[model samples]
Every structure is written in structure tokens, then in C-alpha cells.
Target: MNLGIIGQAAGLYAVTNIDDILVLALFFAQGAGHKNSTRNIALGQFLGFAAILAVAVAAAYGATFLPGSAVPYLGLLPLALGTKAAVQAWRHRGDAEEEKQAGEGGPKPLEVAAVTFANGGDNIGVYVPVFATAGIGGMSAYVIVFLALLAVWIAAGRYFATRPVIAKALSRWGHILLPLVLIGIGVLILIEGGAFGL
Candidate 1:
């Protein structure tokens, strides 16, 4: 429970995850009308982040289970998701009934989780060294702080999504923008990770 450790963990998480706010905001906007949207998003975020942390911890402990070269392949998850969304949007274009039906269901938890995990490739890279240097006690503290901050991140994203200007824009264009955003993120991840030589 060292204050320094807590601060360090918080700073690290903040630095690594600032981009998540926009992603979560898009998710919130897309899920606005669904009954279980918030719950699903939160659950998916936690599950996905947990997986990232697990891998970082395992890698820190010298588990070579997942090689660095394979990290870029994670980009395919978001790429596939974006492609699916684009196809759905194209198919439902200009059909109010079909578009409404498509929008009603919101995103699935696994879909959110997959996106979160796919987007966390850099997080894993940043965390592995930190976890390696941190002893058991320090690692525990970091994990606790990271999880708590994730809740805060989700809240911030929801807040941003609810702002009148943002909300209106998202309501109007989120479907189209979401797919492009996802695709862009996927490409960025792939290029950065050198997946398939970009």
C-alpha cells in the first residue's frame, strides 16, 4: 500500500490507456438504447483488461508462451470486427427498419472484450517490463490500481459520450464512424507491431 507505488501505477495506467476513453465513448454511444449495454461494456472491458494483465504477468515471469512476433496478429481481431460492421452497415444502408433493428441489439460482451484486448497490444508491451521489475507486493499494488483506474476510465468515456454535442453526433454518425475507427486502429496496431510487414 505504498503511496509511491500507487501513484506510479496510476500514472502508468493513465499514460497507457488514455486512448481508451474515445473507444469507450464510441461503444457507449452505439449501445445507448440497449438494456444491458452498460453492464456488457463494463464486463467486457474488465475481462479484456484482465486478459492483458494476465499475459503481462506471465511474460514477466519468463513464460515464453506468447512470442513477441505474434503480438501483431492480435490486430486481426479488430480488423475483422471492423469489416463485419462495415458489411452490416452497407447491407442495411437506407433501410430504416433494418438499421433500427441492427442498432437495437448493441454490441456483445465478447465483441467488446475482443476489441479491448486487441487494442491492448501496446499495454502488454509496456506492462511486461514494469511487472518484471516489480516484486510480488508491488505487482499486486499495480494490479489493484490499474483495475480501479479502469472503472474511472469507463466513467470518463460515458461522461464524454453523454455530452449533448458528442451524443448528437454519435447518434447520427456513430455507426459509420465506428467501423472506420476500428479499422484505423487495427491498421495502426498492425503497422506498429510489424505484422505481416505491414
Candidate 2:
């Protein structure tokens, strides 16, 4: 294993994905009390990141793939999801029974995966050139390190979500805050990518 490659991968993943810790915390907060929520979150995160890596690898190899201009439109996934969540939260406001029922199932794995993939526009952009420059051995090392660190990221998010003070706050306000945050992230992505001319 190349220690330098591993270090580079670790640093890059940490820098690129620091914001994901907060997002994961919010997801965990919403899924509190639901069975298999953590499992689904981890699975979704892996699947989504794998897709991003696959794309980066392919692009590195000069495979024709998604055009750069089309990347920004991926923000629609989170935008739609956030809008739906907001509508649901509004409709169920003050209905403890309905809210409890709604929270019973947690987010679907695919839903989490879609959001993860959609949020990875910058990941793809950053990864492609790095992968292109990396020889096959270095690329493999980077992949291994990145995958391992993903688990650490998930655990950190869960830890934050389960903290007494944060948990209490999220329990009270996560529903509202989650939708707003998702919407804000979506808008930021769109604007940053210059989608629809912002």
C-alpha cells in the first residue's frame, strides 16, 4: 500500500465530504426510532459513493459520459425530495400521531442513495483529474482508503446525532430543519454549478 496515496485520498475525502457529516446527522435524527435506519443509511452511502467513484474512473479513462453541463441538473433530486418533505411536514403539523406514523419507516435506502449521489457533483469533478493522474496501483490504494474512511464518516455522523443535547434539539426541530437544509443545499448546488443560469 502506498502511504502517500492513502494520505492523499484521506485528505481529499475529508475535505470534500466534511459537510456530509451534518447531512447524515439530520438523516439519523429523522430516522430515530426506526428499525434498520442506520443500516440503510450506511448501505445508501456506500452505493452512492460507489457510483460517484465509478463515474470518476470512467471519466479518467476517457469514456464519454455525462456532459458537464448536465451535472448541475442533478440538484433536482434533492430539490424535489426537500419540497416533498416540506409539504409533508406542513400537512402533518401538530398531528403527533401522524408524525409518529410517518417517522416509523425512516428514509428508504434508495432515497438516501439518490441524495448522496446528487450531492456528489463536486466529488466527481475533483476525483476525475486525480484518478487520471494516478496510476492503476495508486488509484486502487486511493479507493481502499476512501471506502474505509466512509465508514468513519458515517460513525461520526451517528455519534453527533445521538448526543444528548443535539438529539434533544433534533427531536424537537429536525423535521423543519431537515427540509430547509436540504432545500438550501440544493439551491447552493444549483447556483454553484450555474444551473439554469442560477
What stretches of model 2 exceed 4 Å from their correct place? Answer: 101-104
What is candidate 1's lDDT per residue for 38-74, written digit by digit as tens?
9999999999999999999998999866788988988
Candidate 1, poorest ten consecutive residues by summed lDDT: 95-104
Q: Which stretches of candidate 1 lie over 4 Å from their true place?
A: 97-104
Q: Candidate 1 clashing pairs?
A: none
Q: Write the per-residue lDDT of candidate 2 for residues 88-130, one digit (tens) a residue.
A: 7787786795465364467778877888888887799999889
User: What are the lDDT scores of the predictions, listed in order?
Assistant: 0.89, 0.86
Q: Output the lDDT of residue 187, model 1.
A: 92
